[model samples]
Target chain A: MKKLINYTPSTATRLFLGLLPFALLLLVYMGASEARLAENPNDRLLPSLTQMGDAIERLAMEPSKRTGELTFWQDTQSSLIRLLSGVAIAALFGLVLGLLTGALPVLNAWLAPLLTVISLIPPLAVLPILFIAIGLGEASKITLITIGIAPFIARDIQRSTQQIPTEQLVKAQTLGASTLQILMRVLLPQIMPRLIDAVRLSLGAGWLFLIAAEAISSTDGLGYRIFLVRRYMSMDIILPYVMWITLLAFLFDYLLGLLNRRLHPWSEGTNA
Target chain B: MSEPLIQATNVGKTYGQDVILERVNVDVHEGEFITLVGASGCGKSTFLKMILGTEQSSTGSLLLNGKPMPNEPGPDRGIVFQQYSVFPHMTVLDNVVAARGFQKASLTGLLFGRQKRQARDDAAAILEQVGLGHALKRYPHELSGGMKQRLAIAQAVICKPKILLLDEPFGALDPGIRADMHALILDLWKTHKLTIFMVTHDLKEGFYLGTRLWVFDKLRHDPQAPNAYGASITYDLPVSQEGRDTLDEITRQLGASRPTIPYKETA
Candidate 1:
C-alpha cells in the first residue's frame, strides 16, 4: 500500500480542499439562520443576511440618530489609530532593543532577564493600572498594546540575531569592520526581514490587548461599540462588527506579508 | 628573511580543564601556501582561528608584521569557511562590494555617488576573475556550491589582504569542480601575491596545493583524561622540497588507527 505521506495532492485538488471547510461552514450558518427566522421573524439571535447588511449600512454609511455623526467610521478610525500607533512604537522599540540585546552582551546582561519577566506578565491584568496611571484617554490603550507585545518581538529578534553564523561576524571583522559597523551593516540588514516576521507573529496579541483595553475603558473603538450595542441585544450589529474586524485583520496580515516579500526577496522561504 | 610575514612562538589554547592546542610554532614568510591536515578533533582549525584573531592564544604570542598579532580580526587577514561564507541577503556583486564598505567607509560602511560606482567596478572585476561575472545579480542561495565558494574567495580577496585563510573550502565540491577550484585558487595566489593558509582533509589536496604542509597531531595522550594533551604541529613539511619523503607514512597515521578521518573515509 502507498504511504499517506507519499500521496501529494494536485494543486487544484489542494485549493478545493482548502475552501471546503469554509463553504461547509457558510452553508450550515445559512440553514440555521433560515430555520430561526422562519420560526420567529423578530428573532435577533440569527438575523438573516439582509438584516445584517442593513445593520452594516446603518452603522457604516448613515449618521447616528443621537450624535449626528457616523459612529462606525469614527470608531474604526480611532481604533485603527490607537492600534497602529501602539504597534508602530512597539516595533521600533523592539527592533532597537532586540538588535542591541542580541548583538551586544553588555546590553543583553542588563535587559534580557528583565525582559523575560515583562513578557510573561499578562497585559490585561495591568489594564486597571494603565487606566489609572496613563488615564482613560488613548494613551492607556496604546500603552496596553505596546506593553503586551514589545518583549515578544524583542526576544524573537534577539534569537534571530544569535542564529546568524559566528563565521560571518568574524569575516566582517576581518574585512576591517568595527563592532558598530558590523551591527549596522551586517546584522541590521539581515535582522530587518526577521523583525517583520516577528511583528506579524505579534499582531494577534497586539489586537487582543487593543480590544481588551477598549472594552474596559474607552468611549470609542470596535470593542467599545460591540459592548455598547450589547445592552440592547443587537446581534445584527455585533455580527457585522466581528466580520469587519476579521476582514481588517486578514487585510493587514496580507499587506504586511506582501511588504515582506517585496522588501526582502532573499528572505523568502527562510522561515519555511 | 624579511622578518617572516607571520611568526608564532609557543602558541597554545585551552578551556577550563581541557587542552585544545599546544606549543604551535612556525614562521611564515610572504607568499607561502600552507595547507594543514589532521584527524578529526585535532586543533588545526583552532590554530587558524588564532591567526584570524577571533581566538586569542592562551599562551605565547602570534606575530604579524613583526608585532604581536592583534587580538581582534583585522583587514590584513581574510578567511573562507566550509559554508556560510557569503552573505545570503546580498547578490554576488554586492557581497564583494560590502568588503569595500568595511575597508573605506566609517561607521555606516556605505558609499555614495562616485565611491559607490568605483566599489561596484572593483567588485565586478574580482567577480569576473572568480568566474561569477555572469551571475553578479544572483543571490548566494541561487548559486551552486562551487559558485558560492568562488564568490567567497572573491569577497575574501577583494580588499587585497596579505593573507587568505580557507577552511576546507572545497570539501563539499565534486572532484571535477574541486580541480577547477584548485586551479582558480593557485592562479589567484600568484596574481594577488597572497600568503595562503588552507585546511583540507584530503592528503593529496594538501600536497597538490601548498608550498608547505603541516600535520596537526597529538604526540602524547593520557587514557584517563582524553584532552590532557592537545594537538600540535607534529610535522611541518615543505611540499615543494620533500613531498616524496613518504606519502605512505601519513596515510598510515591518518588511516590505520583513525579509520574515521574524513580524508580516508571519502578516499
Candidate 2:
C-alpha cells in the first residue's frame, strides 16, 4: 500500500489562476487558423490535418485497428528480430570484455585506447560508412546500434563487478568455496542490482538507436512515417506522431522502472 | 600426550618496512578457551588472519592437529570477524547452508537440489544453539548488531570446525549487549568444547572468558613509539582451574606495582 498525496487547490486560488490563459490561447489559435483556411480553402495542409485527425479518431473508436495493423509488418518484424539478435550478441561480447578488463589490469590498459576511440564514434557518424558496407539493410542498422550501446553496458558491468566487497570474497574463500563457487554465489549476487540497472538503461539506449536507425533508411515503420510527414511540412501529422512515440517511450520507461523497483526494494526507500 | 589442536610456532608478519609481529608462539590446547589481549596494532587480528589462512605469515609455521597448514582455507577452522561478515543478500538459513553445501550431507552430493533437509536441520539446531532460531527467515539487514554477531557465530560454527577463531567478536556491541554476548559465548564454549581464540581490548572480558590470558603490552618496550616493537606478553595468568583465585590475583597485580611473586594465595 502507498501513501496518498493531497493536491487540491483552494477555491480562491483556483478562481484567480486557473483556465483563462489556456482557454484564450486555444481560441486565438483556432481563430488564426480559421482566417488562414478562409484564404486557402482547398489547401493540402487542411486535408492532411483532417487525415491525421481521422486516424486518431479511428484509433480511439477501434483500438484494435492500430494493433498489429501496419502494412510493413514484415519489415517491423525483421527489424525487431535484428534488434534482439544484436542485443544478444552485444551482451555476450560486452560480458566477456567486462570480465576480462575487470579481472586483469593489463587487459584493461590494453583495451582502454581502443574502447575510447570506439565510444567517440557517434552512431549517426557511422551510419554512412555502415550503409556502404552493408548497404542500408538490417545488418548496418543493428551493427550501428550494437556498437553504440555495448561499450556503455560493458563499462557499467565492469565497474559493478570490480566493486564487490573484498571482505565478502575473503569470507567466501575461507568457507571452502572454490573459485567457481565464489563467482557464482558471492560475486554474481552482489553485482545483480547494478547489472539490472545497467540493462534497463541500455534498453532505453536501444530504443533511441532503433528510431535513429529507422529514420536513416527505411520505407516503412514508425520512424519512416514521421520522416514522410516531415518532407511535406505537415506539422499536424508530425506533432501527433511525435506524441505517439513519446507515449511509447514513456511506457517502456515506466515498465522498466516498475521492474527495477520490484527487484530492488531497498533502492526504492532511499531513492523515494 | 594429547596433541595441540592449533600450534602456531614463531609466527611473524610484516607490512613492507613495518614489522607487526615476530617470533610469536602460541599453543592452543584441545578444547581450551584462550584470549589474546592487546592494544591496537598489536597484530592480533593479523594473527587470526594467518590462522584462518586469509593472510600469509612472514615467517614460522602453523599446524592443525599435527597436519601442515593448507595453502588455502578449509572447513577445519571457522572464523568470526569483529565486523559482522554475514552475507547481506541471504537469509540466515542460506548463509549457514552455503558452507555446508560442500560437506557430505548434501543431497546425493548434487550442487542443486531441493534444500537438503539434514543441512537445514543442522543449521536450525546451530541457530537454536546461538538463540537465533526464530531469525531463520530474516535477512542480515533485518537483524540488530548483537543478532548479526550471533548469526555470524552460528554460521561459523555450523560446520563444527575443530577450532573457532573470533577477532573482537563482541567489540562492536553496546555495554548491555556486549555482556549478554559474553555470557552466551561462554555458555556455547562450555557446551560445545570449542577451542576458542578471541582477541579483545576489554581486560575484564579477557579475564572472564579465557582459560589462559596472553597480554600484549606495548609500553614495556618503547614508551614513545610503543607499538613499533611488536607487543610482548606482559601478563600470562591461568584462569581455568582457579576462577576466583585468578580474579583475586589479577586484582592484587593491578594494585601492586612490579610485584615479584607470580601467584598469591587467597585467604
Candidate 3:
C-alpha cells in the first residue's frame, strides 16, 4: 500500500474528502439545535433544520401579502439584475480606459494618476455621497456597484496591458497595424482573460456595494430582505438568505471560471 | 552603387546630459546586409530602433528610400528583436496570418468572410517556407528557442517589408540552433532580396553575416564634460567579399581599435 503522505488521491476520494467538513458541521448543528430546543422551545437565535426548512418553503413557494409576486424570487431577480448591470458597465468602461492608458503614453500620464487616486478611495465611504448625488432609484444602486468596482478592474487590466513586451507592439506596427488595430487585435485578445479575472476578483466588492445600496434605499433585493427581517429577529430567514447569497456568488464565480477555461484554454494557470 | 537605399548623416542621440551615439554617418545601398557591433552601452540597438522609427535621433536625419524615416513604425520597416518578438497569445499560424490581416483588411473585414480565409492561406504558405508547417497550432511558448526565432522572422517578413532589422535574434539559442537560424536567415535574405541591418555581440557572427560591418565606439573623451558626448561609427569595413583573409585583417583592426579610455556607463 502507498504511504498516505506520498499518495495522490483519485477524484472520487477528493470529492468525498471535500464533503467531510460539511458533514461534520451538519451533525454539530443538529446536536446543538436539539439541546437548545429542549432547554427553551421559543429560542430564535439557533433555529433548527425544520424551522429553517419551513422558512425557506414559505419564501420559495408562497406569495407575498402586499404583492402577488413571491418575495424571495423577486429579491433574487432584482439583486441579480442590479449585479449584472453594474458589472457589465464596469467591465466595458474598465476595458476601454485600461486599453487607452496602457497603449498611449500621453493618456497614461494624464489618467493613470487620477485612476490611482480614485482607486485609493475606499468605495464604501462614497456610498452616502452617491445616494445623495444619484438619488435612491435603481440608478444609484447600480452606479454604486459600478463606481465601487470599475476603478479596480481598470487598474488591474492596465497593469497587465503595460506588462506586454514592447517587441509585440513594434512587431504589430511593422505588420501594418495602426494604433486602433493594435488595440483591437493584439492588446484586446491578450488582455480579455485578465479582464474577466479582474471582474471575478472584484465580485466580492461588487456584492458588498450592491447589498449596502439595497439595505439603505432599495425596496426589493436580497440585501433588503436580509436587513428587513433583522428587526424582527427572524434568524430563520436571515441565515437562509445569507446561505443563498453565498451559493449565488459561488455559482457566478463557477460560471466565469467555466467561461475562462472554455474560451481561452491558452491562458490557463497564468491568470486567476 | 545606385543611390543609397538608406542614409544616416550626422546622427546623434542623447538624454538630458548623457550621450549614447554622436556624429554617426553612414549610407546603405540596396542589397547590402549591414551588421552593427559595439560594447553594451554603445547604442547599436538604438540605431536599429531609430531606423525602425521606434526611437528618434536627437540630432541628425535617417533617410529610407531617399525619404526621412517616418516618425512612426509602419509596414515598410520590419524588425525581429532577441525574443518576445511574437505575441505569446497567438498560435504560430495566427501569428503569421495576423500580419496580412492587419495590412490588407480593416478590422471588420478581417473578422468575417473572404479576407480572413485569404489571409490564413497566405500565412500558411509563409509558415511552410519557414518550416513551421506542422506546428501551426502551437503557441510561441510551446516552441523551442530556434523555432520561436524562426516564427518571429516569418512574422516580420510576411508583410515583405523593404528593410529588415534584427537585434541579436539568435543570441539566446544554443550554438547548434544558432547555426540553423543563421542558415535560415541567410536563405530568407537571399530569397526575399531584403536590405538587412543586424546587430550582434559575436564578432564572427557579425563578420559572417554582413556585407557591411559597423563598429560603434566612443573615440573621443572629455574629462571635464564627460557625459556631454556619445559613441560613433569608429570603423566601417565592407565585407562583401567575406573570406578568411578579409576576416583576419578586420580582426586585427578590431583588436587595435579597442577604446583606450575607460568606457562610461551610459546604458
Candidate 4:
C-alpha cells in the first residue's frame, strides 16, 4: 500500500464503527427474546421486535375505539408541547435573570444566593408542591419542568456572563456604548450562544422532570401511556416508547447543535 | 504651543488603605506620543486607566481639553488593550462599523436601515487603510496576533477619538510583529494627529516610539511600612534628538542609585 500521511477511516468504516454497539445490543435482545418465547410462548416480559412493531402500528395508525384518536400521536403531541413550552420559558427567563445578575453587582448580591439555593433543592421533591399549588393539570406539569431546570440554566448563563473579560466591557464603553448599550449589543449577542448550549446541557434533566410530572397525574402523555401499560406488563409498547423518547431527545439535541453551528459560528471551539 | 490636550495634577489611586499610585503630575500636549514605562505593579496601568476615565483619581483631577474628564469612558477617548480589544463574536468589518452605528443610533435603530450601508462603507475604507480589508469577514480569533491588534486599532481610530490609549498593545507579539505594529501605530498617529498614551514595560519600546517618556517607580520604600506609600513618576524625559542622550544618562544614574526590589511583595 502507498504510505499515507495521516490515518483516517473511510466514511463506510466510520458508519460501521458508530453502529456496531447498537447492532450488538439489538442482536442480544432478539436472541434473548427468541429463546424466552420458545420456552414460554406467552411471555410478555421481553417482547420480540414483531410484537413491538404490531403494538406501535396499533397505537400510531389505528384509531382508539373509545376516543377515535390516534393514541400514540396524541400522547406524543401533548408530551412534546409540554416539554417545549417549559424549556422555552426557562430559557427566556434564564437569559434575562442571568444577564441582570451577572452584569450588575447590586442585582448579583441580591439574586445570586437565592438562585443558588433554588438550584440545590431537588426538583422531583417539589413536584407534589407544584401539583398542589398549581392544580394537578397541565399547568402543574409544565411548571414542574420549568422549576426543575430554569435555575440551572440561569446559573450557567450568569457564570458565562461573568466570565466575559473586563477588557471587553471597558472597550465597549470607550467605543461610546452606554451601560444599556453595552448590555444589549455587547453582552447579549455573546451570551445567546452560550445560553443555547446551556439549554442543551440541561435538557436531560429537563426530560427527567417532564416524565416524572407526566407519570404522576397526566391523562394522555407519553409517560402516562408508559405507566398505564406497566400494570398489564406490556413490554412491547413500553420498550418502543422508551426508545422513541430517546430518539426524540437525540433529534432535538442534533437540531439544536445545528442551529448553534449555523447562527453562532464564532462559538465553535470555545463552546463546543 | 497648543493648549495641553490632557493634564493630570497630583493624581493618586488607592484601594482602601493601600495606595497604588500617588502624586502623579503631567501635561500631555496635542499630537504627542507619550509612553509610560514601569515595572509590574508600579501602577502604570492604573495611571493609564485614570487617563482613559475608567478609573477615578482618589486625590487629584485629570483634565482633557481644559475640562475635568468625566468619571466614565466616552467616545472622546479610545483604548486598545493588550488582549480582547476586539469583540470576539463580531467580524472584523462588523467590529469597525459597530463604533459608527452605536455612536449614531441606539440598538433598535441600528437593526433597521438607518445608515448601516454608510457605516459599512466607512468601516471598509478604514479597514483598507489598516490593511485588514481582505479579512473583513474573519472573526477576531481567526486573525494572527498582529492582525488582531491592527483590527483593534482600526476599531478604535474609526471613532475619531481625541486621545488613543494603548495598554501594551504590542506586548504579546513576537519582535518581528512588534516592529510592524510600532510602524503601524506611528503611521496612524501621523495621519490622525491623535494624542496617544501608552503603557509598556519594554524600555526600548518606550524610548523608541514616544515623543515623551514617563517612568513610574517607587521612590519611598520601607519594608515594615509597605502600604504607607506607592509608585510615582520618578523620571520624565522629552525625547528629542539631543534629549535622547540626556535620557540615557539619567537612566544610568538612576539605575546606579536605586537597587531593584521586586514590586510584587510591596504591592
Query: Which of the numbered candidates is closest to the native, going by highest TM-score?
Result: 1
lDDT of 4 by residue, B97-178 (tens): 8877668657522533757888889899989988898999998878888898999899899999989999988888888888
- Tell me the tens digit of each residue's lDDT in model 1 across A47-126: 88899899889888999888887988998999999999999999999999999999999999999999999999988888
DockQ, all candidates in order: 0.61, 0.22, 0.42, 0.48
Q: Can you rank all candidates by lDDT, best first?
A: 1, 4, 3, 2
The number of clashing residue pairs in each candidate reads: 0, 0, 0, 0
Report the number of the highest-lDDT candidate: 1
User: How many angstroms is residue B190 displaced in model 4 relative to the true structure, after the best TM-score fit?
Assistant: 2.0
Off by over 4 Å in 3: A1-28, A269-272, B105-112, B221-229, B240-267
Q: Which residue pairs show collisions in model 1?
A: none
Docking class of 2: incorrect
Model 3: per-residue lDDT, tens digit, B124-194?
98888888999999987778878888998998888999899998888887877777888888999999999
Against the true structure, candidate 4 reaches a TM-score of 0.92
Candidate 1, B1-267: lDDT as tens digits: 478988899988998888989998899999999999988779998898888888889998888988988888888899999988788888888889988998875887888899999999999999999999999998887889999999999989988899999999998889899999999999999999999999988888899899999999887878789899888998899888765555668877766555464465242
* lDDT value, candidate 4, whole model: 0.86
Interface RMSD of 2: 5.5
DockQ winner, 1 or 4: 1
Interface RMSD of each: 2.7, 5.5, 3.5, 2.9
Runs off by more than 4 Å, candidate 4:
A1-17, A269-272, B108-114, B225-227, B242-267
- Which tens-of-lDDT digit does each residue in B1-267 have in candidate 2? 577877878777777766688777777788877787665666777777777777888888878777767666777777887764787767788888876774543222224555577787888889888888998998777778899899888877776777788888887778888878888888888877788889876767778788888865432455465445664455666766556665566556544532343222211
Q: Give the TM-score of chain B in candidate 3.
A: 0.89
